[model samples]
Target: MANYRLVSFKTCPWVQRAAIVLREKKIPFEFQHIEPDNRPDWFRAISPHNKVPVLRIDDRISLFESASIAEYLDETHAPRLHPEDPVERAINRAWIEYMPTFVDLTSGHAYVDSEAEFEKAVAAVPGAFAKLETAIEARKGGPFFNGARYSLVDAAYAPFLQRHLFLERIRKIGQIDRFPRVKAWAVALSERPSTHSFPPAEFEAMYRASVKKRNKWISQFVTEKAAAE
Candidate 1:
């Protein structure tokens, strides 16, 4: 087995996806948290894009971008996470590709300056998730995106769902409830042991700190008591 090191920012969603994939595959890896603002020369040397979620394989090869890192992990590890059927796998890949857009759509609420703008952003959320709901409804079984079996699609979206849950706690957008399938899928992903690859205390602390630092409309919703959880 190659020595894997995941270079990431503690609160990065993209980084979370790669971390989740590693945990799901039961792969042991070293987690290296780097400050995006003060990246070291070594990280810059390995990351052409200067992005988080760089998987340094055996300190020889480096893979940047969450999707590519995930694909590599699935292709190399046992118990492949993607579907066997080529068409089905392609379909899943399409949905996986859509996650970044979905995340952007839902993330707008935090940056908006006013409640009205926040509401508009929140209203736009369901439309993005509705598309996902249709895709999930088309699939066969329970909880996961691909019915009974867990796939890379689930891993791709898990970070978004985890953050969505936190967003809801920060302020109830209620958009998630509008799509039953998406809501259920988020719940199911939350229950997966691999869903939280980062330490809860550390993740929550950094997440809340990031929100507060933004000092935007949503920051008002987060309270000092947030840590009590």
Candidate 2:
């Protein structure tokens, strides 16, 4: 067995995606957390993108990009997470790439300060999810993006959905509620053991802290929750 080390940031969703795939494959690996703002020279040397979720194999070769890391793991390990059919696999890969569009819309919760801006941010979310809703509806299946089976696309979106749930707790975004199928897909992904790949309490604390640090409109809700605890 090859020794594996995953380079990560505590609150990074992308890093969590790689961790989810690792855990799903039952791969034993070491997790190394680093400060994203002050990266070490060694990390910089290995990561051309200077991003977290760098997977190092046997302390020699390093792979960057969460999607690439997840694909590599799925390819090398047993019980493939991707579709066997070439066309289906290609389609799945395309949806995985589409995740950033959805993620970017939800991420506005932590950045927008004014009520007007936040409202605008919230309004834009449904439009983004509508595309996903259409895709889910087209699938004409239940629970996951690819009907009954969970695929790399599910892994790709799990982090974003997890974070969205956290944000919803702070304030009811409810954008996801409009798309029932998409909402069900999110729930199915959440129930999977891999979706909880990171320590939930730890992730919640770190995520809340990051949002608090932003001191935006949403931060007030997070602050209130902290005081209540």
Pick by TM-score: which candidate is best? 1
Query: Which residue ranges in model 2 land beyond 4 Å of their true spot?
Result: 224-229
Lowest lDDT 10-mer window, candidate 2? Answer: 220-229
Candidate 2: how many backbone clashes? 0
> How do the residues 94-197 of candidate 2 rate in per-residue lDDT, one tens digit apiece?
98988898788867756887999999888888888899899888877568888988788888998888778778777787888888988888778777888875
lDDT of 1 by residue, 137-160 (tens): 877646899898898999999888
Tell me how many clashing residue pairs each candidate has: 0, 0
